[model samples]
Target chain A: MSFLAQSAAANPWFSWAYLRTNADTIRALVVEHLSFTVEAVAAAVVIGVPLAVLAYWVRPLSGPILASAGVLYTIPSLALFAFIAPFLGTGRLTVLIGLVLYALLLIIRSTLTGLSQVPPDVREAASAMGYGRLARLLRVELPLALPGLVTGVRLATVSTVALVTVGVLVGKGGLGQLIIGGFRNNFYKAEIATGAVLCVALAVLLDLLLAGFGRLVTPWRRERA
Target chain B: MNSFNQMINWLNDPLNWTNPDGIVTRLLEHLRLSFGAVLLACLVAWPIGIALGRRGRGGGLVVVLSNATQAIPVVALLTILPLTALGFGARPVIVALAVFAVPPLLATAYTGMREVDPDVRDAARGMGLSRWQLLRGVELPLAVPYLAAGLRTATVQVIATAALAALVNGGGLGMIVSAGFGIGIAAGGGQILAGGLLIAGLALLAEALLAWVQRRVTPAARQT
Candidate 1:
């Protein structure tokens, strides 16, 4: 008749003894983790790509933008989480801001490198065909830059997956809740191993998936240096 | 303004500084752990990197291993390592940080050596340079800048991550930060702000110092 007993009865995975405080809530936690990774990486790409292009074109702003991102990237996961928690009050927003900041430098740097790595002749030819700056950037340069862009995405996603565990400190990071739970319970193997193993497994799965996706999108990356 | 004042207030408190568990001691412990990890990582990664580069055969392996290791979140590693005989304190955290630090270091060293000019290598061989001599006289020197740069990146990363040591009795500014957060966000804001400021300042300082070292060790002639 009680809510706790009812939920425990309903869900086979739910147990009162060990993961009582939502510890073994594996399904919801995993979903939260995935969304955290996806949302953060998506935002980074959306914001970072345009900023990178603007930096490239504007020239004067490039150094500062890249430098600031680099500095932001150096802030530790937990430290950043703590700083943001007070402001955002935890949950997805804090995680999102932390991950976006972390990924920005990599995304911007790679986009710049990937665009620059394309031989000048390719651009000249595109221009000769009357491709405007915007068209050439999208059609010619962007495709060629796909390899680096994909690589950035791959790194960001994997790192973000790992970092989401830190969110446990604030009660919002996906796998982290289980991890901290285990830690507090004196390294209960089921809780600790399940959380750690699951987190590592998820990160690797995402990384491989992204790598495969990268190869599919940028076939030229494999064919060349 | 209030929070900022509180931070200064917390920081200014002499009581916060007097204990063995004070920020000063914690900072020292953090430095020791971070530097130990980076040094250990360099010892392991650079040699392996050099060997792989010499044979021109292991960049793929580095990428795979790095990605795999990177995927393991530091928090998980921090918690799990203690479950093993690694015990607690700094050993496991040091190992974990080193594992995390190895990627950039190995990747850069391998790439640096591999990217050396083919013509330069051939000329060295033609000049009858011995294998060891060629490595020392040419390849190793060429890789120094790249190695330094990699070390800088890895070191900065390691220093920042070292803060997490506080989570598991491994003392650092993280002790202050985590304690603050644990005390509840609003009430603990001062401690968190003070700790956060110190860690951020330390990270930036490490970046600048290492960048200087990277710039200096890179031979002037390698500027091109």
Candidate 2:
């Protein structure tokens, strides 16, 4: 008992000290998560936006494509990881595939809604000005749809950050490692504190960034008021 | 020829249905966990969601909390929660899954309430309904459709995430997939595939059931 008390006294704030000492790990984890999220969200936008555009143009296939993506969204993250592991191997590639698929539903739906919400009059005016389909979409439609698209991107970023934590299970790196390591070692303060800090920090940072992005993209929102 | 016939016979075997630990039993366990998590999430999030929706604008704090809680990965949340507590098992798994369900529920509820037309709210107030009465009679009914949509999303997500509970020694069909991966059985691939298929089927069933409920509960005038 004396020895235990001595040990506790010797390192009264051991967990905090340990976390501070491993600040490099925490920084690395944050960097890694942010990079992965950006990559995945970017890939999702590239693929999902085109698919959404195609679905909209094709009309008939939109329902089926959206439905399929919705169903894909229902696959548990771990299960999807497991399913993809056979083909992609259990590393960054597998994690990337899962994140991309997860983002697809949100991004695609957003793109479709954004594009469709462009006023018919705007499109007609663009056509009357002799603008082609591509020109109209680039100038008239996309700008109008920017708010909704940004909203989707913001949501997708949140999802990506959350889901990236799952990559820890397959030996990909993140703050998840700290949380998982802390748990395995039966260190309550360390585990909960680390998880709580990372979660809260990431959420606040992302929300602020997205809100700023929204404000930038939707000047009309400010002008209207 | 004999091996091929045996394989066919194995596929055709009735023993598949009557096995001591049958597929149906595993499915029931999965459903129980999924439903339990959803219920817990609804219990925790509904009041907060309703309040946030009614108040509007100031709900950013709740949204932040919900999003942060959600961003804590299921495996991490399950693993970490139990460390602070004792006897890590299904309880932690359920808590983590419930946390996962909360955000969508809250977001949906808040959006639903906020989306209630201001004109309608003004009319309700003009009719001399108290705030609570207006909420109960007008806002809630209108918000129900959106709430249902959010719940539907939550249900599907919860079911999917519940499969991960097996990682924390909370057995479900995920056990089959995990175990199959452990042994690396080419034959065990079938079990993993089967488990995946089962989850997909359950998700579809849940979606259909929720859609039906949404349609049934929503007033015909507001069907659009």
Candidate 3:
């Protein structure tokens, strides 16, 4: 029943020691946290990328589709999770679906922006080279748009990782389980801080990993810079 | 379909509005928490953003840093912060919401200010305008749309995240939501839906208001 700050106020000396004793448990929680993040981001990309392409290919559909996605994004995460529990039974499925939906608007917006902003002259040159629409999009537009796509995925990855803790409401919380445990223990500061710190670290690590991938794919951009 | 009917019944119930934990009070509380967070976020983030935008040194670092911050889940923050000296209450809720709120707002202000036409800035400088005068007469006006857009984004996000306050000791529309699920299946489902819908409605309304403000500010931002 140790509440972190309250006890920290009393005995700040042993916080690290507390974390040390729980190292193995923290490691396991981090692994679980990563898995939840990956699955959700993967699901978001599967749905979001194609939707982005569709919005690009069909100009008329873009506004409404993007608007709908924006509206969906505005729904608070806790409410959205609770909203679905009736159907999904408060498991990982409910949280995963919410994560996927939350990721879509950011992914689609980035994808559309990246794809659309490909220089018109470059597109014209592609056509002059006798490249058809699909071919031009696949080769020219897609590669040129890599920065935006990379940015989108990077943001989504971190967001998904952060949100994995929220799944505790449904008993699928990864690092969030610790936070819930902390509360149940009457504000066990060390427990909650450990979970929160790990969550932040996971987010940073995932973002850096994706940024590396972005760099690997867009090596030419570095030369330009 | 059956659940929808039940949700409607729950909405129709008089006590849902008349009780101390009624929709009206909760909505007001939600607005207050959201407003408090956004105000604090703007105060903290905007000046630093404007300063950084003037210098243009930290864009790359901030973009990466913000990505990292954005990923820290609201639930974790709510719970963990309570364990801090800030203990559970409206204060911790505002702190968490504002922390998350800062990124988008700061980014928008910085970008907006940065994107003002270089020639416009040069001309103002040529006029022997002091830095303050130039910022007021030139950059700030040109940066309106960008800053407004950022404000909108931050406000919407703060409002949305504020719903998580219910998980802590704070009260808002989330009370209905978290309480519903805690209560059970039938009654809880209906209450959750009502609460969820109300929160969603508030988000959309705030977004629309901000979007209009962004558009309204455009006269000051003459396109180069």
Model 3, range A66-169, lDDT digits (tens) per residue? 99998788887877887787776777788888888888898899989999999899999999999998899889998998899888998888888777776776
Q: List-wise, what DockQ does each model earn?
A: 0.58, 0.35, 0.62
- Quote model 2's iRMS: 3.7
lDDT of 1 at B167: 69
Say which prediction, candidate 1 or candidate 3, comes out ahead on lDDT.
1
Q: After superposition, how far is residue A129 of candidate 3 from its true place, in Å?
A: 5.7
- Candidate 2 regions off by >4 Å? A1-14, A20-28, A186-192, A217-225, B1-25, B47-70, B85-87, B106-147, B184-189
Every model's TM-score: 0.87, 0.80, 0.88
Q: Residue-pair clashes per candidate, as listed?
A: 0, 0, 6
Sort by TM-score, best first: 3, 1, 2
Q: Estimate, for each residue in A120-156, the C-alpha lDDT of model 1 and write its tens digit.
A: 9998999999999999999999898988898898888
Which ranking of candidates, highest DockQ first? 3, 1, 2
After TM-score superposition, the amount by which residue A54's alpha carbon in candidate 2 deviates from its true location, in angstroms, is 2.1
**Model 2 clash pairs?**
none
Clashing pairs in 3: A2-A188, A3-A187, A3-A188, A3-A189, A4-A189, A5-B83
